[model samples]
Target: MTEVSNKTAVDPVERAIRRIQSVYGSWNRNTSVAQMRSDWDAAFAGCTVPESCRQASADGVDGEWIVPADAPRDKAILYFHGGGFRLGSIASHRDLIARIADASGCRVLAVNYRLAPEHRFPAALEDALAAYTWLREQDFKPKDIVLAGDSAGGNLVLTAMLSLRHRGEALPAAGVLMSPWTDLAATGESYLSRATADPIHQRSMILALAKGYMGDGGDPFDPLASPLYADLVGLPPLLIHAGDRETVRDDATMLAEKAKAAGVDVELKVWDGMIHVFQMFSEIPQAQTAMAAIASFLRRHLRLEAERVR
Candidate 1:
């Protein structure tokens, strides 16, 4: 643990996140997905699971509903998890989704989309679309829904919107992204520049995961696979959050710039000295602050009236 006693020392939040990165920094595609999921669960052992939720499976996607006590029934969040498209499930991300649920004061539907090497390319996208359609079937209006995710999940959130647009389907009110990997081609300059600085996520590992997800027939530049190359016009308002220390920093920055150039309402926030998906470290103060910012953005865009209990 970093010294929190010194006044001029690094912030405790920074220290905590760095510690987590150090412990799991070497983790990569070599690790079995099962073990990775187990490790993820252990990393968040301190977090309390949010209250009043149920598990359900429908339309070939598995998910859990996170309904915080006193949450509004009017709006909902469709959440996806991040593990480079190979690992991560609703179980690995339950607490994170629960935190978002608590902060947004709305129910969160976290999808366990199909993983790669087994299911490739459009499989996860199909699942996300299915989950959103299921939510609509539940009577949730398009504008009342908020799509949110981190890392690969963030990429899926963006691509899913593109998929919807291509199909002429309705869109959600807004989208929240955390350190999204918009380019599977790994073409961003930050990938090389921030490689040493980012405590987690190595370029080699990222490419390997991308290969697994892309399979033999998939193209990295496919708009649905890598939304960075996609047209951004007519998309919903977007709130993108990325840490300066992340290797994918340019992914978010470039995506935001491209989206803005294409006339989308985009708010990009780059936090100084933070790493990829810092929001996963709920014990970190910056993580808490970022979640609060997400809540404010969701509230404003969703037009939500309910205040968080915290």
Candidate 2:
């Protein structure tokens, strides 16, 4: 249960999510990437922000960029966009990533990682870890960065954290996950029970995406694919936000339990009646409110220097 008071109605978020699902019911990766992106554009229509407040660079793979407006130079956020690692592009998540930059008071580097049914496993992971390596080589300190993502991107962030830790590199100050699909095995009982309940994600669709991403090489239980299977001994502080109603809610809950058992400081916040990645959809007031909480958590955990001074 959420201990924090939430002022917005959860019903609107649910309705909006269902509306989106209706518009793109159980889409497959067989659609042309162009069509997939265009569909996302149509679905996310009507959201507008100030130009001076949001800028992007497309020179990287697929419109990936470092947003500067309302973006603080003192701190940075490395964000991964979620399309279940099969069907999303940076263009689809541009507005939402900008919101993260604004709320977290940091410069945001939105990564357009490779997708599946084409790139397959380790490709997205390689792209994500490469982004981190590139940022650090550019003089960005690990301690100055906060890693964040939604859905499959959330799994990427956690695995990237572990990858860095295993290599003896310093870890990021914090990590933020929104409705992470950390368990790809479809083991969560909610995967069955909550399929119809979850408006945005259908188990059939996700299982297909998961299979395509897994390819034929290794098990989905591999830490690179499912961070829940990894040893969580050396990661930084983590903040996970999940909707109480998502099919993957059990994923977050299990990961949190494991992290706590491993003696890691994990703050898992479950939003009552909300759905997946609602924080990125401004049409929902609850999303905006959730972003506020996420931003506060990032600042508090990542601002270690300030905390020390205090």
Candidate 3:
């Protein structure tokens, strides 16, 4: 069965994503990672910073804390920014994470995890784990925190949780995944089936990215690299958001299925006519709806009540 159907008109943001893909396709593969990073930083430079959020740095991990003027101090969201684990940074994703913090009425710490083709493999994962540990050291109870990420960042969140579980450490109250690329193996049917529909990612592009992040001969299905193949038991509740029009659509579906089969509490949401990481486009109404849903999920899972102002 085809993964994406022409059921609705394409949203303007999806069109924009198509343009981005075209531009990305034109980028010279021989370009240095530093140059690519600089280019991306410029592309997203116009993203407006939210006045409602306070930004900070932690242990060399760039962080942006978005908490309402009256929100609770004990609860937090440790967010990992996504860039195929090679590009993107706190500056690029700050606006989106700020919106999340505002929506959830909880503090959000957007961690600038190390990138690949330089840091590689466990570097991003290690930073994610370290950021979570830093949160714990700051007196945030594990059960009061939530783990959130998109794309490769999503992989980091899941792998970090798995590492914590294997070490018999405290786990977060829940997790939120937005268009997570959980399978580095590129085995998902959507990779081909949704090719025409998804403008943000293509199979060849994705595989090249995976290889860059993993280096030569890296096992693609190593649980950390591909959490789809990981043991899902003992993980906390999860909320996964995906765009029906995206190549990674099956990544979310398959992970949800596996988590459910493992008896983990998992909720999968597939938005029609949406593109990958559509939540990052603040202008899109569906993005707001998705944020509202994420906020509701966080409040429910974290037992957090919106603070009432005097």
Candidate 4:
């Protein structure tokens, strides 16, 4: 993993951090889940979906097609939004997905998978697999598709890929993970080391979210639940972005080491002083750079022709 230093003005990032902290820091066990979901949606309500994208369903699975103008229809990205598997929706992430489509010059399928506490562990994974299967049935070759996700959604990306590999199905061309929560076990030292540094996520909240997804008896170390323990052999190339200040920073770094040892191509970038999934905050210059890097990595792995977007 490489640590990239950003010299951009910190004022914007600080403001973004304060905004996020204000929202996330208010949550507690007393807050109702429905209210939390609504707040999550409202937080990103200002993000406008690009005019070119269209709404579509993936074989009964709720989703939106973020297709940039003139983008090739054959290539697509399967994006999963992060909310600890209990929150987040197409509404909260449509704008970010649109940016990805605009950057990669490819269509993006952002799915609204089943959330947890209401639907348990295998539910989200099953929904993800169904969406991928729908894409395959539409004649989108596995090589032309890329899997991308952030946080808990990133966990889904890994588990979904593992499920496909185990079923003898072909894998996607590559994967892009942003601040992935790979270790449900929560054993990473960053939880302690970065405790004071991370603004939004903390150990207590992480464990609560894990329990909400896993229920009372779910195994934290289960390879399916936590890809940090899963075999990484034969998975497609991965581009992982992480923030050094985030509590899950170790999750990205440790996964990179394991994937590399397992012979999978892995590129891990640790952005100094950024927060979890910092790409969601467009005001931050690092977010723009990160999106560009993601676009370049996808084009290279998918063998798409480089065409400048005006």
Candidate 5:
């Protein structure tokens, strides 16, 4: 993995990491899932949804629409939030989605898929597929839709595409993943290499989250659950972002390699000194750069007009 050196002793990236650690580091196996969900939402409570955005439902799944004023009505981004499947909500990721909508000039449909430990494996995947199908039913063609997500949500993006392809359904134009946890088995080498560098997530934490999502009798290597083991042939173009310091860094790298081998167009970026899903922190300059790259990729794949993109 290529590393980008951060010359600044203490910068916005460091501060953001510290802040996240301060809030999330205290949690342990003893912490209740409800409390963790509350804490997670509270951490991003300051984020404000745009006035144009509104609460909406995709099929029966709860979600919100993030519509930039200039965004076209036809093209849309289907978003899934991260938090290891058991946590995160539309509220926690509203700001980041809003920024993406503004940058790409496409309305975003951010869904709050059912969480795990209660919903378990296949539940979130079902919700994601339902949302995508709902969008298709709305007359949004698959060519105009893009699937995007972070961490476990990124996992859903891949699985959703695979499922659709298996069912002989039309696939979306492209996909964008941020620090996707493709391997629920957590067997990536970066778990050992970047363990000390990643402040927010560790091997133990990842494994626990994975287990909770999988539950008893669930296979960690199941292609639907852990997409790294799945056949990636015929999947859409992908743009993957990862942090050099993240323990799951290899998840992004390995997936990109495998997808490319399977003839899928893949672009992988490993940001130096960044943490998992660093794009959530707008204060970090790298976050802005990553968002811009996302916009560019989406605009190209979605065939959005240059005048429409900001």
Candidate 6:
């Protein structure tokens, strides 16, 4: 497992972030509806993709692809952005996606899936399945593609893999999940202790989002929303990254155990100290270190050993 943690000294980026969060902002997932919307808009407002990157669409699908300039010989990354199932988009994660594309030597196709409180569990699940199927229909071989996501997106990646397996389809070559929310039940002990450490999510925030998304639709442990309940048998090799002090630390650890128990090849990495979605802060020293860990993990499973060497 790659140690996807940014455990370095504080820098300007971290210092500025600390300042903002210390006074006006908060890492708690319980921001007001208006404030959250504003933050989300600002997060993705001025994103700039590379010139070689272009917009791509598949037939009857609702997502786009971020094709890199120098196309790799053989590999593709189907990336999913994280916003607790309620917010976030491909545009919001352009910089991170670019890094993923460059590191994996694969075209990164990020999703702008439907959100929660408006669109529920199966909606995102359905979108993920549709996207995977569309990618396959476009001639992407199972072994040529990899599925990766962060937070809620991570959960969806697994759900999609399980659904594809259930439908008797081929799985991706590998999968990367960062700070995944595997357990919507919020029963993990880390959820309590790490609540203070988690910058963007807490039990209260999750419960609120669940209420908005579930809205009496079904149980939170329906195996789709919270993949920890699913039978994760015969899945592809998985690499999970978590922060030891984060709320979902145990979530990753527990999911690793469950997947291992099911005989699936799984690796779980716990970083020393970081916050939820810490991998996004590329400017931070620890974030870069964490991204390298993830890159190494993907290389190991995908046989792209020439990556870092190059």
What is candidate 2's lDDT per residue for 1-310, written digit by digit as tens?
A: 8587676646667667666776576467576766765687567643254323333432243334445344445567888888888766666676777676566656677777888777889888888888888778767788888899999999999999988988899898889999998988878877887887786676777777788899766588988799989999878888999987788888999999999999889998888878888776787777888888887887786572221111
TM-score of each: 0.91, 0.86, 0.91, 0.94, 0.94, 0.86
* 76 Cα displacement, candidate 2 (Å): 0.7
lDDT tens readout by residue for model 4, 188-295: 999999999998889988998999999999998998999999999999999999999999999999999999999999999999999999998888899999999999
lDDT of 5 by residue, 108-146 (tens): 999999998999999999999999999999999999999
lDDT of each residue in 237-310, candidate 3, tens digit only: 99999999999899999999999999999989999988888888877889889989998898898898763342
Candidate 2: misplaced stretches above 4 Å?
1-11, 26-30, 45-47, 51-63, 66-71, 304-310
Q: Residue 193's C-alpha lDDT in candidate 6?
A: 85
| Model 3: per-residue Cα lDDT at residue 68 | 62
**Steric clash pairs (candidate 1):** none
Please give me the total number of clashing residue pairs in predicted model 1.
0
Clashing residue pair totals per candidate (backbone < 3 A): 0, 0, 0, 0, 0, 2
Candidate 1 lDDT over residue span 1-310, tens digit each = 8756656777765676666775477577598766766786566544375467798774668988889787778789999899899877777677888888888788899988998888898899999999999999889999999999999999999999998898899999999999999999889899899998887777887888888999976788988888999999999999999999889899999999999999999999999888888888776678899999999998898888856545
TM-score of model 4 vs. true structure: 0.94
Q: What root-mean-square deviation over C-alphas does model 3 reach?
A: 5.9
Clashing pairs in 5: none
What is the lDDT, from 0 to 100, of the residue 300 in candidate 6? 68
Off by over 4 Å in 5: 1-10, 26-30, 48-51, 307-310
The residue pairs found clashing in candidate 6 are: 6-286, 27-199
Residue 89 displacement in candidate 3 (angstroms): 0.6
Which scores better on lDDT, 4 or 6?
A: 4
lDDT (Cα atoms) of all candidates against the true structure: 0.86, 0.77, 0.85, 0.90, 0.92, 0.76
